[model samples]
Target: MNKISRKGFLKIAAAAAMSGVTAGALAACNAASSSTAASSGAAGSYTPGTYTGTAEGISSTVKVTMTFSDSAVTDVVVDTSGETASYGAAAAEELKNQLLNAGSDEIDGVSGSTITSDAVKKAAKSCFAQAKGEATVTSVQLPTGDETDWLGEEPDIDEAAITETVDTDIVIVGAGNGGMFAAAYAAAKGLNFRVIEQNGNVQDTRHWVGAVDGFGAQEQGIKMDRAKLLSEVSRYASGKCDQRVVKTWINESAEMIEFVRSIMEDKYGVKMIYTYGDEAKWPAENAEHNTDYMYPEIEYTYDRSSGAARNELLLQYIQELGYDVDFKTSLAKLEKNSDGRITGIIAQSTEDDHFIRYNANKGVLLACGGFPGNPYMMEQLDPLGTSVTTACSYSPSDKGYGIRAAMWAGANLDKEAAPMLFDRGVVAPGVDGGYVDSDTAFGGKAFPGTIRQYNPGTQPFLKVNRNGERFANESSPYNDIVYAAAHQPGRVYAQICDANILEDAKRFHTIGCSAQTRNAGEAYVQGKMDEAIAAGALFKCDTLEELADKLGFTGEAKDTFLATVDRYNELYDKQNDEDFGKPAYRLSAIRTAPFYGCWLGASLLTTEQGIAINEKGQALDNDNKPMPGLYITGDMSGSFFANNYPCLMAGVAMGRTLTFAMKAVKQMAGLE
Candidate 1:
């Protein structure tokens, strides 16, 4: 054996191809004694030696030193100094154990600390390849960007360059679901109004909508204790929410939703149905849950996922009242009078490239959704740039034009955390990857799979990060799994399965969408898996060792991957999961050959961070005082969520949007 410098590994890349690692891993003649500190079966290209290497991690850089003699790793030292020492400490400990178990540079990444784990693997590989006199080293670069990109510089266009003007008592910006409701109430109140919609029509891209809140529709005869509802929401808001505003949200949701329902059903005969899925129903009778979170029942507009809803109905009602809206028109800015009061609005026609001004005699309301389509806004809210992961929020890239118009006009904005979630979906076939079951990732469209087809991709089967380490409880709900994935090294995870896993999902009582319907046959599901594997959405390998290597596992990762499967199989045999407690039925072992996997990025519904508002639905400034002549509704205001979407509040975003629209309409029209 020959001694080499740290850089020696990089020097041998071309030379090591003649004797590749794992070339004869299983031969009996390869055995070496423990005294030699080498592989018991001295079969691969390790070349018996010690070496060191370095790699980048989540929050820091990591250095690794390894001792491999006779093709078997005998010792490992991980230096995770770059990762805020405390957080990296535990990760280092976990990585050491994983490395020792595999006795080779093929092992699992630490679940909670993927960045450090990746660093360890890369570092180990440097040593292994160098020891083998090989120069080739695998590198896994993390995806990068400011995870939050929604907040950016305000629009720079001058407002004085107005080309046209329309004077009205009330001017509404945006024609989405929330804006439409405000428009209808203004129309009903006989207030002079004009609506500027960026899209050609009232289009909303939400498939699921509904909320179970405190005060439901009184006329519908299902109401909760208003006081309790108010207190609950106020608590949920964590003192960050205006108690008064929360109270109004609780008091008005039912009436607003019911009123819209009445207008749509009684007049048009259109019906609302409960959206069915994982989030469809409220929490059941269980100790870990309460009833109030179950109060406000959620229902969806029948059929069309992106079709008619309350807002669409409200748009019709506004038209019935003889109010006309400008399609393809966008709000450019809001002008204030010398007294600090909102006076008028400037807008542009997307169709003709022309600007129009609307003088507001009474007020101007901005109900465009939270800056979902603005990358600058995302950058501000989520510095990690996770928004770029998938097409969860697919609104027109108006870059939050309406929200900025409000902010520029002296309206206050809330800088709270907004977490995007993937309700369901799969890695799209073509482009990088996306949620296929719930969201469209590639080409702005979803794949052709019935719930039974793509649902298997999302079911809570065993999963691991890029380092081949199980990072979460595979049986947990969508939110838990997603939260884990978001914090991983690359903010990504792989759902592990053998070729037979799909068949097991079909044959056994798998949870998630599978519990709702029978999956496609085993062959069909395998075919789908193979297709995803070919597209790189999913990885396939003849052996687990290959799977571990492809995922960037090193040292003990490969051994741990096999051991993990064996241990999980033992757990499955006993019908109990001790490691993660994944429900027994979901505990199928990864035994079959030609293993498969789908890489899942975090999924999101929509982003709803926005301008703060008062109980009166008036836009508030930094001082928490309402900005006169301005109001926000829909996704534009009343988002009190701290992080994850409130569980059991299916469609609460739409609920709040509609509720605030009603209140904002009343306030802007001076009816409050």
Candidate 2:
């Protein structure tokens, strides 16, 4: 066998037509034998051989490879590359060491990575079983079908196999921002509701919670043009979105914020702060009308971590109210009556795979998240999104199950896909942007590369395609760059800058989430850049030519890159952008030494389109009539957004989720 680089293995594994027990699996083993004895008395003897096993992880499959000898465990490798970066992926090394040191799968799990740790142990056990010749091969292959078939046939669950049943006034699917808020309001209204989530705890991935004309903005003396905001959102969606649903958020968002403040602050003693885009500003030359797209103060906790802190308190408050969020419970299917009214749902216990029936007397709210983590849905609904996206912040829980369940129950889905994209997914040289045909535990295409977050990529830098030609105005909305790059060569672009990046970013004054690094000061920003440089995610060189070569610009592409730089410098010197109509203040010449380059596509935060709904948060049928006793919220609900998520408002997505969650609960309780 020929020796292959790790990067080569990753690239090959992604595109390979993998069957049961793939060759990549054997190659990934690359095992080493050891005679080291077990440290604990429980360490049992094993046959001398290399073995591999796999199990389901937080987002994808976790594979374990082990080499064993009589009375000892030798070398071990845990492949957690598919897991969440901050949690499961980070726990890989520790889990590997634990397996080797203990000589058994019974080892302590890493903190905050329980799911991955459990998967590692399970896979390790299977490896040990294989080493012992116990005939236990535990790897399961994902389902595959025609490329265009994302909504496969509905599951034919056996009714007699259900182990138990429960009754409730309201049944809420998911314990994310939408479901949690719905539960909080339900508890307050004295409604007996059950909230079910597949994950072990609540999901809080974002911080900002946008609202229009909320008390926080009022206290700060900030005002908004309702009509202008409405028109801007309509324009963003190309008028495909339901204006009535958009208007509902515009009208009730203030009330939602106050309700959040009441629970987080008045009840839980967690102080919240509301902020407008004060830290970022457009150039003075750009008229005030250009700033009309900005939002008023949005609510947030004290810091990034505080968002989760407040959520923990909210969970405690719900538990104290004699209600509980059922974790490790996955939705199976929606159960409806013959009258076309949703009656309840069938949920599977993630721990035991046993099915349980939940009967909702009032209504059922589907706040389960979108399909950013589900590759099947991405391939079918948003192939362009799947191609350009490299990373996802969503979890395995967001498998588009809620949306599919609604569709199976006669709900109509949005004809167009709406994905919330950010210009931050950083790739390395030679990696083209496209969907990788890797088979995952969740049936979808995997990202082609190991991408990192290039937050500063949000700055309006001089971006060029593989042919080294300037593509578009980088100062536009985040998703616009991704869409534009889709039409470019290799479906990827390189962001080029110079040593004056710190000062340039400060002057760029990009608003919304882009302003985060700019506000963090030069030191923080430089530190991040340095870290990226150290990680080989960024290319830094003394000359533009060297930078171009490092970024994969060859021959004519290199010359074009040099010419593009010179032309960009000319524009910067003239303080005008004639090609793309970019604001002059945002232009920064790439003349300084020690140039930097990073290949980018887009990072997916979540998908924004799903089952179509009305202003009342009720799912709509094919005839545009509301589906009785069925409500939708969070990313699972659509019609308020159509094409791309409007990130200019910071937390509009979460705000819309919470606002409509309240609407759904109230509507079910007869208060609407």
Candidate 3:
């Protein structure tokens, strides 16, 4: 008998343990099987019995169960072994289904687990080959390609590869809500069109997002007053957003909503509901209060009624369109004829490493988002700003791929406009302080459930710097809080709130308590919290004096910090924010016992800079002229918002840009 090495034995033992089979039991079974196989091999015309073959470099084991009646390949069961939970299990199940139905080695790869699928295929092939006395094991390589494969690459113009080119009425990049709308509109007009997406799926972010609102006049039973939406967005934009863009969004908002509704109901067979709930009131009071500064008549919230269902439906609609929609492809380079006419796009597949030429018979629309995920881009855009990102709450793919593509194409850069950083409150549990999801702190005033609520608003808390002195209003906007934290020395400190406020927070928002408290929230509710703790947010002591000692505050500064808290509390109790003019509802004193402080780190939501585009959604060069054949939209295009974030009815800007791109396509194809 061959001796099994310790490493091999341990691996087998681990596999047996995971399968809920004792190591001794597995060893006995293996010994019996080996003896039976050896006896069978000794007989003439004897087929090899079932063998568990473990492949190298794959996370899973392949169980090859073979049954032979008269030794003529009667049945085969290829059960993938050693699969991880969730994704791996799903992949294994899919493999099993494929094997059962096909009874062949051919199998479709599972989405999001391509490597695992390949591993299974290889293992199954090896088992079958060994049974048939043929070579089955083979090496496989990981898939790769340029940006067009997964990051939405552009076309290669250096070579004349597109020989049989046909003009498309419109070429839209990205398959998000914006790109989808553009394609649908073009199709409705009986125009030739194609959409290019770097993602492997459509409506990628939308499918994962929890809720969305602020579409212009609701259509398909989604009813929002246009005038009200415009006012609300204008106020949120703080007089910095382009009025034309805002107006265009309002005018077409209802149409976009209606379009989405139609796609959900008619095509996808999914019902679309208002998100703010049935009462027509904003879902949360915070949304209402914030909107008061903009449009008082506009309800602050509406229930989409369902998130998961809506996404599934919307994706189905896009798939049904039958338009030339390419996925897992990226834009490599833009093509322009010497005449300066924007012509075609060069795309590459990340899986196959093949370049596909997509001739934009009309024009190419860019609907990529901002560059908040790019650290280098952030520094260039906001030299004075601290490095904080909010994309962690959203899509991991929201990297500045689009922006970089545009820049490489000589597109103009918008220096002033960028996404603002917002605070994500609540750090990882057991840590003194950490980063929190801005939404937890600012997501409608309702305490973001237990998993996120780290700080109470009414707490008599002082945001002290390393010097242990109070800075900025505790009641300031969430973004402001993040900014202060980022600018502070070491970019961290404790937020000293009194015990009474903590108790109230615990009572009202169960999740806001520390880990030490029962029913406490998760260590890190948001993706960025882990990152923030690495940056800073510490918690310390019960009394102001103790906290001061720990934080290294001494003498007059400590006294000043206490005095400031007292003065702020006096104003808070009186419901008079004379110092900061904070609203009465937000004013509250922190004069309670057993004070506690949680450290908070600042993180940003949007990028502060992006590619420059005009009101027409045309990408412009540094010379302020449109880059022929190129258009940009979403966060990728810049100069839309100034100092503050824009509130253009949710998905309005994207909808308008897509619509405009469709129109441009029509004009290019001489169909207009």
- Writing each residue's lDDT as its tens digit, candidate 1 over 346-404 gives 66665554567799988888877754443335556654334325435345333455666
Cα lDDT of candidate 3 equals: 0.47
> Could you tell me the lDDT of residue 622 within candidate 3?
80
Stretches of candidate 3 off by over 4 Å are: 1-167, 187-190, 206-241, 265-292, 296-312, 388-391, 425-462, 474-477, 484-487, 491-561, 592-596, 647-672
Task: Give the Cα lDDT of each candidate.
Answer: 0.57, 0.75, 0.47
Lowest-lDDT window of 10 residues in candidate 1?
A: 19-28
Q: How badly does each model clash, as a count of residue pairs?
A: 56, 2, 55
- Clashing residue pairs for model 2: 375-444, 376-444
lDDT of 2 by residue, 426-542 (tens): 877767676664434343256654544668988889999999999898887788898899998877899999999888988887777777677888877778677767756788899
Per-residue lDDT, model 3, residue 330, is 60
